[model samples]
Target: MKSSLRILAALAPLLLAACAPQQLVRHQGDAASLAQQDAREKQLAHADHWTLQGHLFVSNGQDGNGGTVTWTQNGDRYEFILRAPITGKSFRLTGGPDGAELDGLDGGPQTGPDAEALMRRVLNWDVPLGQLRAWVMGTRAAQGGVAQLSFDDNRLLSSLQQDGWDITYPAWDTTHQPPLPAKVFARKPPFMVKLSIQSWTMQ
Candidate 1:
């Protein structure tokens, strides 16, 4: 029994080492892959046509609203539609070089030069549509604002801040090629928006 105890004690260190997890190492290959992904993201930034279907939740200090969102982007033009199933109300916002037009089931079309400001006044939701175009792609907006960004172990964007908004990518579509954000949350003081993307189609 004494010899058996001694043998087991001698093997403990080996057993412990075998059970330990391997240390993660970042090498040149990892750096190259990250650079390639960065280049791809930059290419996607210039994408002229794309469509996204998703569910969105928006909240302000007073109330919270949720609905389906369908956004289509074409060059400098964009069309955004939001619908609240509970109330059966829908709003459409379109913007181009001319200006921005917002229409809803409750009122006539409202026109303005800025879509973000228009949505805030019309729907009472302060949504930054221009910055969102880049943010939704897991990249920061190029408006030259101070940005703070973080990456996950996979070298994918985990969170970012720009233009007074803090955005988090809690989940992504890893099953698809060039993984895209699956769930995102953006927040500013008194306002917050959450998005769950159902489908993405790029043209």
Candidate 2:
């Protein structure tokens, strides 16, 4: 426990280092990314509740698997629940950096390497479950990333960019719509994450 905390603590400063204003303003993506970041932040401040269900494919996208994710945010903190289907076996994980207990896992404090851990390092986002939930859904939280966001239809948060990484959302609903799956495409060379919106609803 102590070692994990120390590792995370040590990481905090490095993460902050990457968040210098210059990085955010200097992303190499086209103008669309900046516009989306701005637009997404604006929409997030107004949303009450949002849930995104989709097919999550990782590790080169050849896994041929799917999953559903639901996010609920009351305020600064939110809960992201993910259930993944891989090779006929199902696994679920719930919890964020700020949360003490993940809902459906039993073992020790998972102090090992995993996809989520990699994302935390690569993205430098360690907000509570709800905070990230909101950001992904278009809310701006305390994430230190050289990021820019853009929106489509001027409401639903559209795209985001951080540290040479970028996400482009193609399908978006403009008029305060629901049941819209905001697809975000991420690129970072050998690592890619493609998320598809399968369902959306208010809770």
Root-mean-square deviation per candidate: 18.5, 9.2
Which pairs of residues have clashing backbones in candidate 1?
A: none
- What lDDT is reached at residue 130 by model 2? 30
Residues 1-203 of candidate 1 have per-residue lDDT tens digits of 32222221211111010111122222323565557557757777677698888877655544555667787889999887777657556667778878888766334677788776665555544555667788887776777387766666676766666887777777788776678788777667666567788888888
For each candidate, what is the lDDT?
A: 0.62, 0.42
Residue 46 lDDT in candidate 1: 76
Residue-by-residue lDDT tens digits, candidate 2, 75-103: 43444455544323233333334443233
Error of 2 at 20 (Å): 24
Displacement of residue 194 (Cα, Å) in model 1 is 0.3
Clashes of each: 0, 7
What is the TM-score of each predicted model, taking all chains together?
0.77, 0.52
